[model samples]
Target chain A: MKLRKSEDSENEVELNMTPMIDVVFLLIIFFMVVSELSTLNLEEIELPLADESEVLKSEKLDARHIICNVREDGTIRIQGNSYKKEQLADYLKVEADAEEREPANPSNPAVPPSKLYLTIRAHKDTKFENVQNVFDACSQNGIYKTRVMATKDE
Target chain B: MIARLLRRRPRSRSSRPKAVEEAKLELTPMIDCVFLLLIFFMCNLEFVKQDGLIKAFLPKDRGQSTGPSVTDLGEVRVKLLWCAPGTTIETEDRDVGEVVLKIEKNVYPRSGATPDWEMLYLDLVKMRDIRDRSGNPDALPVIIDARPLVPHAAVVGALNACVKARIKDVTFAAPERPF
Candidate 1:
């Protein structure tokens, strides 16, 4: 094979397409993974508006909390996976059982409570009965620490 | 010799620039496609909503109440219910509001007039002050009880009111429903 050399040796540079394409593909993959991971625990639900709400504090949002999502149709979801009402009860029971229960407060307690917290994200249009079901399930499991999610337009 | 050189055309030398052009890859199309993808991903990315949290306390009736719930406590109960039909109420969000906001004994009926949640919040603050004067300020647990048909927005609205009132002890009433 005869190599064709450019007579004026300025080295006619050939831009490599392989590495560029590789980087582009890697970027696409990165975005895909990041978007999926970011939205794993959250659902696309319209939160109710709150007149006055405190800004979320990072210390309050620790890794030990469970994010429970309730859709308008009363479907319960955890980590993007949908669960039935009975299944949710069973799930909470397991979580509650896993946590070490603290001594019951004499001032207001009938039983010892678990320290596990549950954050409920319910759609604004959802029926109160749906939220009640979740609240009841958490309470029955001894997970009394709970918070409801809302958004402020301002 | 001059005649022979002239007859031999300088084709390769004349088209050397064309050969160089062919040797280099055309990056414009690929770059265009890459930019399009970047724009697509950037536009597709959704920022999570700034959701605020309202803490809630749920009661567990395991057996019996121990000591009148945190010693002597002045409890405030807020009940929300769906309004009667034909009572057209529109909230600020343009949602047709039907939630009746009741704080203590004063009732803000959802009967045609818009129920002011802000007013209910103020009443809770006043009641909380009254309880504070009696010594158990932190023990004034505001229970928010809503009917089944009431929307979650209504419940959150009440919860928001309680939180804004700085009532530390807030509970959501999940009373046993009569089937």
Candidate 2:
């Protein structure tokens, strides 16, 4: 009986989680690092606001006009003219160049002409894809400054 | 030594048998893997939650545009009106007009006389010029009014034009749709 009891005690099973925990922690760290890296290359998207404050009196907003109009027939116009959907990149490049040339003021002396402001006017029925396209164009052309125009209800 | 000597009574010809048991999986390792996977997915997931994609008009300090004097300060109010296939655009202020371009029935051809593309590009360039001349390019706010039937592609084209023209501020005017 004593020998049998000793044998039974030797056969008892138990699990060790130390190595498993170590592997899990390592994996967690790996994922954390990867997620951080992935976000670095992600695009910065500005969500459209409903209750945005009015244009400030600061002098930074003193140059360049960007008017976007979305029509019912699926026609898009900047100012009065419509642009081909594909030529957005080229157009932005040209606009950015023009903005760089026109100095905001010759008398200010402190403000460089390189600053250009952008105004995006999207219609109520406009698709999100259209807005994204505009953003993409601006990013490609190095025009980071932007604003949204809204109308007040009576 | 005395115990061994006492136990050594009979010498039988028999070899010691080998002990064997079935292999078993470690539940702890699998549980740990499940937890790790859960954490990975939770961290990597990007949830995109946005209120409706309508343009919001920010408050202008000057209040609302009421009369001619307000309009003369080089405040260019560019209005976009949305319409159906054959509907004409109407505006609250008659002076603020709508530019209509018909959508061609044929597929937008890649080559032969891309009139639509040319028109859109020209309009954007012209607006840019006006905004630059206004001296306050950043404040040149453009408002867009669109109907329900308008295709989303058209709106995108408009946005692209604004970006191309270096116009940063844009707002959409939406009135509650009556059911």
Candidate 3:
């Protein structure tokens, strides 16, 4: 049998890898940035679902905000450190004092709210008392602004 | 000139094409390695989590007695109490108020056992519409005064209702225990 002649067999094709490498490097950078933003000091807990809950935005995410993870056992967890009910109050006062104090209330000039942004992340099944204690602690420390984290309802 | 444009001629008729002069590159290995790295990073990457929050600013009177004793109760106060099934507000187990919206004040069922979250939502919506007609939609600030032991879900439900009603401000109350 006679062999068939192939024209492409003699030509050497070189793919330019510059663009591919550039694209790859760009993808790597994108992932790195996203991972850095996701590395927040937060504890994982089951949050309740709410249809009208406000979605977390970049503006709402401040660098100095504290997250309190309350469990069914009534212990508050902050960045993996657990604080008892009694201890939470003291810890919160210290944290509140560290942040800038809010401007004095227009109605009540004597008691200014704390500038501390407190986010309460509690298990859905956890009793409200535990969360209330956190609020009470916040109130004692003059922190009035709070947001309870929840899952967005479909 | 036409032949040169249509087809490039070999320098020598008996020799190989001019392109064969450069060394051949083994692209398969490089492509495979690149894909492997991409897969590794893709597998390792974590997706950003999406969460919602129920916004609240506690009343100035919550934890301290030193604040002004003037109690600024909400015009529309939604109280969530903890009660058992088929039990009246008086008979509710105080240890854990499992999120019943109606007790004695919001007595819808008359039996007073079941909490009415929907009623709370409807009432707040009605309040919003009335305020809107009066041209002060944002004038009403709602206070969700949930008992200490009520389930957190119940409070969220109440807050969600107020938010849906487009209430301007929603606050929680730390009322003195009224046993």
In order of TM-score, best first, we have: 1, 3, 2
Model 2: how far residue B57 lies from native, Å: 6.8
Looking at model 2, residue B146 earns an lDDT score of 39
Q: Candidate 3: which stretches are off by over 4 Å? A: A1-40, A58-63, A106-111, B1-45, B60-63, B66-74, B90-98, B109-116, B131-138, B175-179
Residues B1-179, candidate 1: write the lDDT tens digits: 32233234344556566645433334577668877886677666755566788777565444232334432246788877666545433233324446666665655544322357787788888888888798753658788878776789888888888888888777766555555
Residue B18 shift from truth in candidate 3, angstroms: 37
- Candidate 3 has what TM-score? 0.67
Deviation in Å, model 3, residue B50 alpha carbon? 1.3
Of the native A-B interface contacts, what share survives in model 1?
Answer: 0.68
Question: How many backbone clashes are present in model 2?
Answer: 30
The weakest ten consecutive residues by lDDT in model 3 chain B span: B1-10
Q: Score the docking of each candidate (DockQ).
A: 0.40, 0.06, 0.35
Candidate 3, position A14, lDDT:
42
Better of 1 and 3 by lDDT: 1
Q: Residue by residue across B122-178, what tens digits does model 3's lDDT show?
A: 777887777678875356767777776666777777787788777776777664554
Off by over 4 Å in 1: A1-10, A60-62, A98-112, B1-25, B42-46, B59-73, B86-97, B109-114
Query: Model 2, B20-128: lDDT tens per residue?
Result: 3433444555565669685765656554222222222232222122333323343433333332223344334323333333322222222211124345445556766
Best by TM-score: 1
Q: Distance (Å) between predicted and true CA of B110, model 1?
A: 6.4
TM-score of chain A, predicted model 2, versus the true chain A, to 2 decimals: 0.51
Question: Who wins the lDDT comparison?
Answer: 1
